[model samples]
Target: MKKRTRINVLLAEQPIGETVVVKGWVKSFRNNQFISLNDGSCFDSLQIVVDRDDVEEKILKQITPGAALGVKGKLIESRGKGQSVEIDAEDVIVYGPANPETYPLQPKKHSKEFLREIAHLRFRTNTFGAIFRIRHAISYAIHQFFNEQKFYYLHTPIITASDAEGAGEMFRVTTLDLDNTPKTEDGKIDFKKDFFERETHLTVSGQLEAELGALALGQVYTFGPTFRAENSNTSRHLAEFWMVEPEVAFADLEENMDLAEKMLKYIITYTLVNCSQDLQFLNDQLEKEESQKPKNERSAMSLLDRLQFCVDYDFARITYTEAIDILKKSKPNKKKKFNYIIEEWGADLQSEHERYLVEKHFKKPVILYDYPKNIKAFYMKVNEDGKTVRAMDILFPGIGEIIGGSQREENIDILLDRMKEMNIPEEELYWYLDIRKYGSCPHSGYGLGFERMVQFVTGMGNIRDVIPFPRTPGNAAF
Candidate 1:
């Protein structure tokens, strides 16, 4: 077997006049001579010059768009316009032939919605190739940033007995027959016969388990898939998505906000420097996308500018009450333009309100804290006024609420009271309560939705487009 060089390496090194073996899917075949090939190593494709007279007719006929091919060729300076180097094919081998008539991806642009329906083959397109490559870079940057900060990477259970978010939107995991479930004497369906001998569901968050690790290890983070049985069919809602949850011991809400800000800046800066080529491609793509929209609806800044703005400046920090006040005075609210109007305090601010604070009000990333206790989770620390909690949400320009976290309620009695007030059963989360009982210290953490970050970085409009296979309300197709 001959060694094959990656297209990215060959393009970068430009080993002129050297015989090399390259294998990839054909991006395009022009006039039975020029072939554009890409192997997913990078965004750019290599141009192959094939002499129609030298190559057999059968071999030439098989080199269609989307066909897999191996070519033994000599690399040389290109006479073409886009690429600096081209390959002169000495021999051609077809690994697989894609019929041009039936192949979904023809040599033409396809809509993102259409490509999503054929996600398995969408990776071959230039847009998705750049998006997924950037996705990998962002994931790497996340781990690298945490490791440098001396945080331990902890793996939490996907199927958990406790409801971390207490939202009751979890996917139930059961092995019992649903058609004829066993019932207790009182007539309620029995969960004792289930796989775990008790009720369990896919975790909505890993903060509860991560807190245990943080207490033991000082700092810990969990990056894993989280599930929610939400029936929302909007572009931003996904039934299953990735989450990055970091927990720290002996940290207050202020320190928690600082960590979240630092981590986000580090990762975004890393992607900007390391994945420059892919980011540039996506930036131009976003520019083209925005050009089609009306001037009022288009983004205020370019994609690259938006990312740089996030890294270059300190995020504007304000309280949720302050944000509500600004929204009430804003023209949109006064004119009744917002879908959910902000009439008064203690109201749960929707995405429109969040975006207004970030994009229109501050014109940069904003961090809103000290939310009303009634709107936040029971685990958040209650303030001295007793009306608000030490909760914080980091909002980005385009994507609202990129991160949500807080200083946890370390007082066992307060935790119990809050849980009871929310009607959450105490027995199910006894272990969580135990942590508060035994030598508990103030700890803080936040959960960043991984897909939302990717969407912000890549300037993708839909959350489904950021994840490889989106699990939504009625659509779970690959």
Candidate 2:
């Protein structure tokens, strides 16, 4: 058997004159003499200079844009303006050759919409490659931050019977045929013969499970896929999106905010430090596409740089009542015009309100807690005031609500009462309530959309473009 090639052993700068062997799919053939080969090594492909005499005629002819090759070469300096070190190929072995005609990706540019269709091959593109690399790095950074802080990594169940958030956004899992669905004598459908012996669906958030574990472990986090059946065809919504929710026991709203802010800052910082090449490629891709790009976004090399500035700077923290006051005041004397006019209370905040507080008024990240009781989650702790609950949503400059968290209603009476009020069946959440009954702690957690982070970091316009295999409304093509 042939020995496996040690890919990504040395970076271009590390060994300028030393020989290296890399196996990767060819990104592009820059010229007849130059081939951009990225061997799963780094975010950006290393440019390899190929001489006409050095490579075989048949071998050289077959090296297409997406062809996979194992190349043994010496790292040399490049005359190219965009990059630094280039490789001088000694031997080129073709492992896989992607047909250029049928290959979804080529040298030409493609739209985010176009890329979403060929989601399988989207990662080979520069934009998605960078975005995915950042996604991976960001995820690891989440684990790193929490793990180092001695937080237990919790794996919340995927198939759950309870709706943690009473948002009416769950995709029910059934084994019944729609053509001949089972029904009871009375007009009710029978769920007993269905999957799991009862009604069940995908979990929207792991906050409840995380809470149970956190109460025992003190600090716990759940990083997994969350499903929402809402047919939202926007740049931000995905039918199935990964969520990173960390629940802390015996922690207040202030402490929760601090942990979240620190975690965000850490993730950004880690990605910047770890994946520099990937980020630069993403930045260039964004600049090429967007003409009227946000000035703040252009300057950021890594998301962490922005987060570091965020943590160092004071975040704008105000009550829902205070925000209402500010919004109402703005109506009388408008300093700047807002797209969505905000001059009210009792209603849910529009994107305009969130943007105003985070992007305009604060000029920094704003943690908007103490939301109206009617608009917020039922499990959230009722604030000192009668009408509002201690539910906070972290809003960033670019994205409106990146993180949504709240102090859980630890009091069993209030929780059960709220559940009853919301019409959530008590029988379904027997295990969840057991956590409250056995040993309850003042726990809190936040759900962060993973694809949203990818969008934020890579500056991608669509959420579908960021995820590898996006499960959108009626589009699940492999």
Candidate 3:
């Protein structure tokens, strides 16, 4: 028989009662009797039962956890003790042995914090592997949803000169000599002398470029890395993260919200169907971390059923004014904890308020619109109220502000005047101004943080734990 190497046989029908070869890193080893290996092919564990007299004496040390090995075996029906199937070895070949003294992983469970420190090795763990696999599945689902809807995927530039949302939270990029940085006559550092011949930074959002594409292609989305210089050390914050920005030409605020809701639902359902094993693993191993509930006791369907209900039901839409009014007059019900706090107009809603609004008040995902113009981005269309802008934030039960979208200020005169009012240099954005002069249509778009969506789907707490290599303020660990 030729050398056979297979990681997993779980996908095959009736894998047992026949001969097969197994190859993988040993996940765990027993006292010369049994071993488990994860070949990184499937979520299910493959069992390698070793009888004391069946293997060469050299095989003892080689069959340890983290060791690479291949076993040519008779595929016999499993006794169904540890697993559904077993491989009765006919020949064993040791590829490499991971030193038990140095390897961090063993049969014992490791904490997420400890695992995060060794990102390179963490993927070997069952939990991280499951999360990442689901992450990939979710990404595929997003593309599938858009592709089915005929939306084009547009590649946005990483290095952009525009502030995009005017959020000042940007990582500046420069190539001038560090020792003798160029300065203007007034002693201020001159950005004009930089490598780009002007100041530039990694994009904080892809909306601007996405808008350009949307204006041309009618509907487009940019899925790429977005950087922010904010020093927030919260579970939800990341210095560098990926964003999915979709802009639709001639789309208004209502249509934009509808698209967002449908997209989120589609992703949830997709992950549930494709990565059910991984998500179940995450829920059993990690999701209970939220409330100390055992995974087996909970039958959570990745909250897909809840979102399906949302798809069938109309999303609760409320104006900012109405939200404030409800908050001011409401009693402390289960869904209105924030109602007990001070309620006032023009005050930025806290995460607690957002959660309360969606979880307690609406008991579903809620869309709140028409934020005070001064508190909203300058690009947002001003409402008829003159004080509120056409801004919308979609808040989910556990994930607040999952999507932020708004209609653009299409009137060039008003937009230019708004820029001037904000003291923005019009000369820097002359090309952007030309878009308005060249027949701009009323457009809308939103930015959904990719990792944030994963968190909501996988129920992962920290954004750092969700991404493969998380980049945060002053922290970039391998």
lDDT of 3 by residue, 161-236 (tens): 8897787999889998989998999998898888888888999988877877888899999899999999898988
Q: What overall lDDT, based on C-alpha atoms, would model 2 receive against the true structure?
A: 0.79
TM-score (C-alpha, index-matched) for candidate 2 = 0.91
- TM-score ranking of the models: 1, 3, 2
Q: Return whichever of 2 and 3 wins on lDDT.
A: 3
lDDT of each: 0.93, 0.79, 0.81
Model 3 TM-score? 0.91
What shift in Å separates residue 62 of candidate 1 from its native position after superposition? 0.8
The residue pairs found clashing in candidate 2 are 268-304, 269-304
Clashes of each: 0, 2, 2
Clash total of candidate 3: 2
Per-residue lDDT value at 179 in model 1: 95
> Which 10 successive residues of model 2 have the least lDDT summed?
1-10
Residue 370, model 2: Cα distance from true site in angstroms? 1.2
What are the runs in model 2 whose C-alpha is more than 4 Å off? 1-8, 16-19, 77-84, 287-308, 331-340
- Candidate 1 lDDT (Cα, 0 to 1): 0.93
lDDT of 3: 0.81
Tens-place lDDT digits, model 2, residues 9-118: 55534577877777788878865788888756566577788998988888887899889888888877777776677778888899888887788888888888888778
| Top candidate, metric TM-score | 1
TM-score per candidate, chains pooled: 0.99, 0.91, 0.91
For residue 364, model 1's alpha carbon misses the true position, in angstroms, by 0.2
